[model samples]
Target: MEPELFIPARALSKFVYCPRLFHLEQAQGYWRDSEETRLGSHVHRVVDRPGSGLPPLQAIRAEGWRTRSVRLSSAELGVVAVCDVVEGVGDRTCPVEYRRGGPAPGGGPWPSERAQVLLQILLLVRHGYRCDHGCIWYDRVRRRVEVPWTWEAEREVLEALSEARAVAERAEPPPPLKHSNRCPGCALLGVCMPDEINELAGRDPEPPRRLLARDPDRFPCYVTEPGSTVGVRNGRIVVARGRERQLSMRLRDVLHLVLAGPVQLSSQAVHALAEQGSPVVWTSTGGWLKAVAVPVAGKHVELRRRQYTTSPAQGVDFARAIVLGKIRNCRTLLRRNGSLAASDRARLDDAIKRASRAEAVSTLLGVEGSAAAAYFQALPGAFRSDNRLPAPLFEQTGRTRRPPLDPVSCLLSYLYALLVKDLTVACYALGLDPYFGLYHRPRYGRPALVLDLAEEFRPLIADSTALTLINNRQADGGMFEVHPTAVALTRGGRRTVITAYERRLATEAVHPVFGYKLTYRRTLEVQARMFAAYLLDEIPRYTPCTTR
Candidate 1:
């Protein structure tokens, strides 16, 4: 028989507030920290600590006693809880729960908060303690509200427990609360994508609310200097080279840790980044993604189950959407930046039509190849004439990889690597397997899903960044080391390109379907979550982000 699933008392509170949020956290093991959650942790700092101040239940008498972080469980109720604070006097006990925000407008405890306290009291009673009521201390208002115990409250708690268990047993979560105000402040707003999913599912004719922040506060911390040592010190990441300090940054401000070339990262640093949900990406000196160490918490078995069980027809349909978006975006780039001949433009338009009509993955592949060849032939026309470099550098025949044959190819390849790395990190954050993909066939040591998603973004992000670098004279032939067979960027060139690439990611653009502005970096995760929602059948179809 399967082991009993012990629901946490806090989870019951979540269910009472929003069943979909509870399902995302408790069932799928997904979580994202927000300002409110951080403040709540601060409010509970003292109460989160365990102390053996209170005597045992049998020894309790007239003297009042209190204990912090008291652990209790009830197998009969299938519940476990860590009461923030437990106080008792003369055989009567109460659980004291702490809240970061103020009480309800009417100065009463919210139903979810009351349910949490009630469950705690029930657990205490089951463990042979006499508990009559509970308290909720709202730190923000500096007020305490009493939640008196009664049969009705007890019944509500029990019914909520039964409902939560039922929801957990299902393969998919319950529908999101329609047009609810709670979603705006929710910590998982981006992960849940309630409004976006509703819009895509055709249940809502209006556009999705711009709930997600325009840009993340934290950014990637890159250590590119060779022979550097990365270590954690006082909740900060310290980078040094043989006792010479290079840079120091607070751990919270770092989105991920990127170690390129021969840098060494201490175990403590790795553990710290993992705990913060920031992946550690390892890359070669030439910017090739070698490996990644992501947090284990990102593993969501349910989503992976859906991914593995996808039908061939579904896979082909998804692949078509990805390729179609890519070809259209590529054509858009040519029109906006490059001086495309009528024939070249017509060829691209034809490729887009063929891609849309192609039923087989093989046919789509051929269409994509044909489109890429025509697109690259005209790409060089977009570059401005530079006195600092030879014309041959910009006038490349076609896109080249595996030791790019020209400076333009070299820069494009490096930018693509950066793009793939970001997409891989986004996939892991959403609990999706980056190696398994719908369009790109899975291959050993290849991030197929990352490539699959990168298709739509290649022209918009990577190619655009590369073009900006060339047109602005930010990159030139002097920054490249040309051997007989291969061309690569020098260290200085890599730094310049990386800085420009990050700038491009931070630049804002209006989302095509949502009609709201967001940075390229934020859009990556949003698109990834939309794909996840599609896999779980939350949305009827997965729409790729396309540039206008």
Candidate 2:
């Protein structure tokens, strides 16, 4: 396998707060740009806009502006990212990043932002710029906080980078932290379901306490005792059934066998009894038989069914319907704006036209663009199509979701990731207990629930949202002159996208089958429920909805 890439300073902040999250993003490469990430991109654009002021220099004429270009890279460490501003203060240089939000909790500058600055410092140092400090300019707080690169700060930055590298080494995300709440505004919140992991790992494993009573009937053949046995073996209570050697009782299959003498069972037996799906009672003097908790897995399949139920059609249909509705909403919103300039409209129309053409989507799927190819180019085997990337099955050919990299489409795609993230969040919110899963499989510390939840929405949310942005004038590469990377979004681009997403989500649509109008939020919850049902075996499998 290819070695894991080291994360840039900005990403290190994410890891420091939640190692699992850092793993999900950097290691797994399952990036789902969030509103915050997009917004940060948007802001970066504004900062990098032409004629952006830079510090003045002495060599240039008096009217000359002192502006220095910001360059960043961590190639040696295997991390890379760019800085917004690099200032030349006397003989020393400092990097400054504009924060989209307030300082971190306890009044510390945002760790990720600080990390970004440190990386910037490293970049400048590599390029022979005498760097000493970096500053984070908070937009919300309207304050600029300077970060001095002391030995401690540099060590911390390096340490954070090292830890991030370690986390990225795993294909799956790391286990959630023991005490999360370290980084309140972490972008990977949806990816890292820390609460669920914590709950599953920290819970006391010992069986619950039980009470027993004496029964005087069948057990008369055995000896008499009032105490309880502590351990069980071979699915049978290895207790002395009679005066002879210990006899095993099929605790699960047997209903009841009355005993006159006393039989004792340990607390473990009581738990085993309960796990058999029926409670057991052990008599102090009679044969030990009392109600006990049953292991959930042993419960009848029918019992599992009654608890959670959903249909294959329901889940896929729900996901597809949500995507379609959102796409339609995006089209409507763009048209209503009416004030869109010709160039912007032309760009959007071109994107939509491309999306409308059945060939484009197929072409996109086939092309291993530079961005995608860079990561996979070194792989051993030639590209081969499989079920995951099968040729179009539907009669209609076009964007299955939306065209890639359109501003609105970008927003929608990120929103899908957001939804997945939300599912990860919901997994934590709900105490279903198991932290890892089947499709996502339980690693020592992975949050399988979130991975499970995000599966169906990948096509529905992220792909569709990305298409919408392209099809609509809300965003386009024309603004930046350079075509936007499919994976990254500019800051202004992010805000425009997020605002539109929030608006689109609030819009309602009548469910084609249910006949009742449901908000996007409700649809997401239903999809989540269906996932829970699948886990409970109430559904056979999950399939994403395919549009005709």
Which prediction has the highest TM-score against the true structure? Answer: 1
Against the reference, the lDDT scores of all candidates come to 0.87, 0.45
Local accuracy of candidate 2 as per-residue lDDT tens digits, 407-486: 33334444554454345433332323324443333576555545455543443445344434444534455322224333
Give Cα distance to truth, residue 458, candidate 2, Å.
Answer: 21
User: Against the hidden true structure, what lDDT does model 2 obtain?
Assistant: 0.45
Sliding window of 10 residues with minimal summed lDDT for model 2? 211-220
TM-score of each: 0.97, 0.37
Clashes of each: 0, 63
| lDDT (tens digit, per residue) of candidate 1 on 165-199 | 88877779888777789999998888888887888
In candidate 1, which residue ranges exceed 4 Å CA deviation?
1-3, 390-397
Model 1, residue 335: distance off in Å is: 1.0
lDDT of 2 at 226: 28
